[model samples]
Target: MQSPQYLRNGEAPQQQQQRLPPHFHSTVSVQKLRRFNTLILVFRFASFCFCLSSSIFMFTNSRGSHFPNWKDFQAFRYVLAANAIVTLYSFAQMGISVWEILTGSTVLPETLQVWFDFGHDQIFAYMLLSANAAGTTIAWTLNGQDTCTASNAFCIQSYLSIAFGFAGFLFLGFCCLLSGFRVVCFIIYGFRFLVL
Candidate 1:
């Protein structure tokens, strides 16, 4: 219970203490938000590219010969369809992310945008994962068959397509984690103190 140091100096505590400029916290928070938005943009772009490649590779896998084409299998068709849908979704998300980065605000309300991203990321990621798994199973089974020996290109391309699908899923998984964190923060802070 000793007397305070400021009282001994006859100086007010507010005058003696150092205070940062009012903009300091806000500036740092803005920079953090821009960086986060940019990161999300990158992830969205990556997912788009992977999904696009997966779709393309599967689409062009037909050799027009006796070889089993991608259309011959239901799993391969699912892979193509899932990748195509995710590619479109990723492209749209990238646009939104870019808008936020450039404007420091979202086209949609912050709460809606955050929840929308989280829900879509989860759904698309799981769809891509399941499609890839199915495609890989088909590819693996075909690889073990004697017929695969005659069509090396078909097998290789199918594997490549599945690989790209998995890569897309990986990026979407990252986006999901980020958006999940955003959703939780929004829920707790109600967007007032949530920087991302």
Candidate 2:
């Protein structure tokens, strides 16, 4: 007995139906975001392990008078310490993100705060690593003169140490740059949230 609701142009009422409820879309978006965050955490953990292992190898195997002397060993030890510190810091960041995701509290505000924290942590870690590498290279090179003693063996080791140290420093620098970019993106998002 009752007529169907229609638009002023006579369209069917069903034509005005929304594709999805707001809650449904929000749930899906949150799930996807959580998955992404989890993946990043996994990658970061893996990287930490790799760096730690490499540092250990440099410290343990690359030693002795026939190879590197006590000074060289000391340099490698410093590098190992730096690597360990960075790994721990990264783990802490990952843990925080995981906690947020598990609690279903990973909103824009929380994520932005995490980003800011991570950026600062990353900057410090990277700078420390770079400084450690530079110091190690300088010590190894200067001490190589005494250890190598015209055999060229110490010179070769010194060059190898320099190469490895520089490579590590460059890699950390690249990571620092990437973190800076992430911080910028987070700032933009935070601004948008505040504006809206």
Candidate 3:
């Protein structure tokens, strides 16, 4: 005779279905990839904003300050102009990135193709940032001897500006590298998909 407990319940046996882990599920969405790309673009745009505002502040405030001398002022002007150019370039890059993500256009030709396209853009960014850092360092060193100025204040501000600018550029460069890596991976995965 069947067990009384099973008869009383009058239920069929339950079956357990297997599922992929959360991490596996997390990696399987095209929508999630688009969202991540958008987030990165937003972050880069924010960095550009910071660079623009800081460049403006440095240009305007340095003109009024007595420590930077006339030659230093000219250097700062160059730096300001470079920053503006880079900011505009960054905006253009962001626009293109956003469009690509929206259109689900991750696949590209040879990895060199994408690298050349994005590399030129990032090279300009790096040049501007490096020039800004070098100019500020020189200005600070030149102004450090002014006895009437507060102790080390000019030097500190200049150094801080250089540090922040370089850090930002480094982060931007890393992102560019990561983007190149992603392109390579896409190419490899695309080939595998075709083979399968």
For model 3, name the residue pairs that clash: none
User: Candidate 1 has which clashing residue pairs, if any?
Assistant: none
> Which prediction has the highest lDDT against the true structure?
1
For model 1, residues 118-155, the per-residue Cα lDDT tens digits are 99999999999999999999999999887589889999
| Model 1 spans > 4 angstroms off | 1-25, 192-196
lDDT of model number 3:
0.56
Model 3 deviation from the true structure expressed as Cα RMSD, one decimal place: 11.9
Q: Which order, best to worst by lDDT?
A: 1, 3, 2
Q: Higher-TM-score candidate among 1 and 3? A: 1
Evaluate all candidate structures by whole-model CA lDDT and list the values in order: 0.89, 0.55, 0.56
Best by TM-score: 1
Per-candidate TM-score against the hidden true structure: 0.85, 0.53, 0.61
For candidate 3, write residues 55-166 as lDDT tens digits: 6555544334555432355665666666666667667667766876777553444355466546764686667666776677576566645622643554555555455555
Per-residue accuracy of model 2 over 1-196 as CA lDDT, tens digit each: 9999887567676865734543242566567656655655665565456555545544444445565542445555665566656657656756765775687555446566657655655675565567466656655666546555644554454445444544544544554554554466556764211111
